[model samples]
Target: MAYLRWVLGRLTAAALTMTGVSVLIFAAVRAMPGRYSDLVLGPLATTADKAEAARRFGLGGSLPEQYGHWLLNAVQGDFGISMASRTPVSAEFAARLPVTLTLTGLALALTVLVGIPLGVYTGTRGKGGGRTGRLLGSLGLSVPEFVLGSLVVFLFTRYSLGLTVGEYVPWSQDPVRSALSLLLPACVLAVFCVAAVARTTRDAVLGVLVEPHIAAAVARGASVAFIVRHHVLRNASIPVLTLTATLSAYLLGGAVIVERLFNAPGLGSFLVDGLDRRDYAVVQTGVLLAAAVFITTNLLIDLVCGLVDPRISALAGKARS
Candidate 1:
C-alpha cells in the first residue's frame, strides 16, 4: 500500500511537471524573434508568400487557439510536420530514437561494468590505494566529451588500426560491424560516467564502512569480500543508482557531439540538422523528447531511491500526513 501510494504520487508529479514543460516549450517557441512562417519561407520570400505559408500552416490563429491545437495533436502523438522535411515530427524521432538508444545503452552498460568494480576496489583500498583513484577521477573530470570523441576517432579511425571511418552500420545489416563502430564512442562517453560513478561509489561505500554494524562485522573477522558483498555494496548502491540514472538522462543530449564525430544518424544528429535549417517542429519535438527523457529518468531514480532506502518512503509518508 505504501509503495502504491508512492507510485501514484510520483505519477501525479510527473504529469504536472510534463504539463508545465509543454506549456513553457510552446510559449518559448512562439515567442522566438521571427515568425515560424518567416523561417519556413527564406529571407527572399515576399511578405505575401509568408502570409500564405502562415495560413497554410494554421499559424494565423490566435496564440491560445494555436496552443490548443498543438496540445490536442500532441496528446494524440502527432507532433505536426517538420518545416524542413515536411515529415511528421514523431516519424523523424521514431526513426532516430533507436540509434541513440543503442549507443547510449552500450555506453552506460560499459560504464557500470567498469566503474562499479573499480569503485568498490578503490573504496575498499581507501587512501591506501595510493593516488590511482584520484588520478583516474581527475582524468575523467578533466576531459571533455567532444575532445575525448575526437581523440578516440583519431586513434582508431585516422590511425587505420583496423577501425575504419566510424559510420554506423544498421544492426540488421551487420550486427558485428554496428557493435564495433559503437565501441570507441561508447568508451568516450563512459569516461565521464566512470569517473562520476567511481567517485560517488567510493564515497558512499566508505561512508557505509564506518557504520556501527559494518564495524561490528569487521571486528568479528568478516572477510573483506564478504563485507563488501553483504554490507558495503548494498548500502552504497543507492547513490550509485541515482548517479547512473542522472547520467543516463545526460546521455540523451550529450550524444550530440559524439554522434556527429562518428557520423551516426541518431536524434542528436537530427537535432543539429533541425537547428541548422531552423526547422521549428523538429527542433521543438527533439527538445521536448530530450526533456521527457530527463524527467522520466529522474522520476525513476526517485522511485528506486525510495525502494533502496525505506527512510525516503517514510519521509514521503510523513509529508502526506
Candidate 2:
C-alpha cells in the first residue's frame, strides 16, 4: 500500500511537471522573433505565402487555441507534419530513437562500471588513491565532449588503429560492428558522466565515514572492507543515485553536439536538423520527447532510491500528507 501510494504520487507529480514544461516550451518557441512560416518559407517568400504557411501550420489561430489543437494532436500521438521535410514528427523520432538509446545506454554502463568502483576505492583508500582520483577527475571534467570526440576519431579512425570512421551498422543487422562503431563516441560521452559521478560518490562516501555508526564500527575493530561494503556504501549511495538520475536526464538532450560530431543517427541530430530547417513539428516533438525521457528517468530514479532507502519514500509521503 505504501509503495502504491508512492507510485501514484510520483506519477501525479511527473504529469504536472511535464505539463508545465510543455507550456513553457510552447510559449518560448512562439515568442521567438520570427514566425514558423518565416523559417519554413525563407526570407524571400512573399507575404501571401507566409500567411498561407502559417495558416497551414495552425499558427493562424489564437495562441491558446493553437496550443490546444497541438496538444490534442500530440495526445493522440500525431506530432503533425514537419514543414521542412514534410515527414511526420512521430516517424522521424521512431527512426532515430533506437540509435540514441543505444549510444546513451552504452555510455551510461561504462560510466557506472568505471566511475563507482574508482570512487569507492579512492574514498576507502584515502591518500594515494584519492590523489589519483582527483587528477583523473580533473582531466575528464576539463575536456569538452567535442574535443574529446574529435581526438578519439583522429586517433582511432585516421591513425594506426585504422577503425572505420563514422560508419554505423544497425545493431539488429550487425551488433558487433554497431557496438564497435559506437566505442569512440560512447567513451567521449561517458567521460564527463564518469567524472561527475565519481566526484559525487567520493564526497558522499567521505561524508558517510564520519557518521557515528561508522565510527563505532571502526572502534569495534571492523575490517575496512567490511565497514565500506556494508555501512559506508549503503548510506553514501543516496546522493549518488540522485546524481546518476540527473546526469541521465542531461545526456538525453546534451548529446546533440556529440551526436553531430560523430554523425550518429540520434535524436540530437534529428533535433539539430529540424532546427536548421525550422521544422516546427519536428522541433516540438523532439524537445517534448527529450523532456519526457528526462522526467521518466527522474521518476524511475526516485523509485529506485525509495527502494534502496525507505526514508526517501517516507519523506515523500510526509510531504504529500
Candidate 3:
C-alpha cells in the first residue's frame, strides 16, 4: 500500500511537471520573433495569403487563446498540422520517432553493458585502477558532444573506416545495413555514458568495499570474486542505477547532436528542420514528445529504484516532510 501510494504520488507529480513543461514549450516557441506564415510564404507572399495562413494555423487569436486551443487539441492527441510538411504533426512524428528511439535504446544498452563491468573491475583493483578510471571519466566529461562527434567523423574519414557515415538505412528495409549505419552513432553516443557510469559504479563499489561487512567477508576467507559479486556489486547497484538514470538525459542531448552529425532521420533532425521552417505544430509536438520521453524515463527509473531499494520512498517522504 505504501509503495502504491508512493507510485501514485510520483505519477501525480510527473503529470504536473509535464503540464508545466508543455506550457513553457508553447511559450518559448511563440516567444521567437517572426510568424510561421511569414517563414512559410516569404516576403513574396501577399498580406492576404499571410492572413489566410495564420487563420488556418489558428494563429489569428491572442497568445492565450492560441495556447488554450493548442493545449485542448493536444490533450485529445491532435497535435495540429505541420506548416512545413502540411501533414498532421502526430503523423510526422510517428514516422521519425522510431529512428530516435532505436538510436537512444541501442546507445543506452551499449553503455550499460560496457560500463558496469569496466567499473566493477577498476573498483576492485585499488588505487592505480581508480586513477585510470577517473582520468578516462574526466576526458569523457570534458569533451562536448560536438567535439567528440567531430573527432569520430575525422578518424573514421581519415582512416577509411568501414563504418557507415552520414547515411541512414531503415531497419525495415534492411536490418543488417541499418545496424551497420547506426552502430557508429550509437558508439559515439555511448562515450559519455561509459565515462559517467564507469566512474559512478567504481566509486559506489569502492564505498561498498569499505563497509565493515565487506571486511568481515574478506576476513572470513570469502573469495575476492565471491565477495565482490555478492557484497560489492549488490550494494553499489543503487548508485549505479541513479547514475544511469541521470545519464539518460545526457544521452538524449547527445543524440540530438549525433543524429544531426550522422544525418539520421530522427526527431532531432526533424525538430531542427521544423524550427528552421517556423513550423509551429512540428516544433511544439517535438518538444512535447521530448518532454514526455524525459518524464516517462524518469518515472520508470523511480519505480525501478523503489523496487530495488524500498528505503528510497522513506527517504523521499522524509525529504518532503
Candidate 4:
C-alpha cells in the first residue's frame, strides 16, 4: 500500500515537473532575440513569405495560445514540424536519439566499470587510496570535455591506438565500426564522471563504515566478508545509485559537446543545429526530451531506493501524511 502510494505520488510529481520544464523550454526559446519566422524565411523573403513561415511555425498566435496548442499536440505525441529541417520534429528526433543513447550507454558502462571499484577500494583501505581517488577525481573534473577529447584524439592518432573519431556508422549498417566510432566519445564523456563516482562512492562507504550498526556487526562475531557485504555495501549503495542517476543526466548534456567534437550526429548536435537556425520545434523537443530523461531517471532512482530500504518508503509516507 505504501509503495503504491509512493508510486502515485512520484507519478504526480513527474507530471508536474515535466509541465514546468515544458513551459520553461517554450518561453526560453521564444524569448531569444530575433524572430523564428525571419530566420526561417530569410530577411530577403517577402511579407507574405514571412507571414506563411510564422503561421506554419505557430508563431502567429500569442505565446500562451501557441503554448497551449503545442502542449496539447505534444501530449498526443505530435511535436509539429521543424522550422529548419521542414520535416516532422518527432521523426528527426527519433532518428537522432539512438546515436546519443548508444554513446550515453557506452559512457555510463565505462563510468560504472571504473568509478565504483576505485571508490570501494579507497573507502575500505587506508588514507593513501582515498587521496589517490580524490586526486584523480579532481583532475578529471577540472579538464573540459573538448580539451580531453582533442588530446585523446591527438594521442591516439600519434600512437595509432584508441577509438577512432570523425566517422560515425550506425550499428544497423556496420556494428563493429559503429561501436568503434562511439568508443572515443564515450570514454571522453565518462572521464570526469568516473572521478566523481569514485569520490562519491568513497565518501558513502566511509560514512557507512562508521555507523553504530557496523560496529555492532563487527563485535557480534560477524565475518569480515559478511559485514562488508551486508552492512557496508548495501548501505553505501544508495548514495552511489543516486549519483549514478544524476550522472546519467549530466552525461546526456555532455553528449552535445562530445558529439560535436567527434562529428557524431546525435541529439546534442541536433540541438546545436536547431539553435543556429532558430528551429524552435527542434530546440524545444531536444531540451524537453533531456528534461524528461532526467525526471524519469530520478523518479526511478527514488523508487529503487525505496525498494532497497523500506525505511525510505516509510519516511516518504509519513512525510506525506
Candidate that scores best on TM-score? 4
lDDT agreement with native, every candidate: 0.83, 0.84, 0.86, 0.89
Model 3 CA RMSD to the hidden true structure, in angstroms: 1.9
**Which window of ten consecutive residues has the lowest lDDT sum in model 1?**
30-39
Between the candidate structures 2 and 4, which one is better when assessed by TM-score?
A: 4
Per-residue lDDT tens digits of candidate 1, residues 1-321?
777787889989998998899889877776667656656776789889987876655566888887788778878898888887877889889888878988899889988998888888888896875268778988998999988888787888557677765578887798888877777777788899999888888888889989999989989999999999999887998889989988997887789988989888889999898776667677778888877887898898888888888888878877897
List TM-scores for all candidates, in order: 0.94, 0.92, 0.93, 0.95
Can you write out model 2's per-residue Cα lDDT over 157-218, one digit (the tens) per residue? 66768566688888889888888887777878999999988888888888899889999999
Instruction: Find the number of clashing residue pairs for candidate 3.
Output: 0
Predictions: Cα RMSD each: 1.8, 2.1, 1.9, 1.5
Per-candidate clashes, comma-separated = 0, 0, 0, 0
In the range 1-321, model 4's lDDT, one tens digit per residue, is 988998899999999999999999999998889887677777799988887877887777788999999999988999989987789999998898889999999999999999998888888887898888888889989999999998977887778675566889987899878878999999999999999999999999899989999899888999867877888888888999999999999999999998988889899989999998888899888898899999999999999999998899898899999
Summarize candidate 3's per-residue lDDT along 1-321 as a digit string, tens digits: 777778889999999999999889989998888877668888789889988888888888788899999999999999998887688888888888778878888899998999999899889998989988999889977888888888888898788778858888988899888878888889889988998899899989889988999999988999999998788886899888877877777776668889988889998888888888878888898878778877887898889888888899877776765
Winner by lDDT: 4
Q: Of the pair 2 and 3, which is ahead by TM-score?
A: 3
Worst 10 residues of 3 by lDDT: 245-254
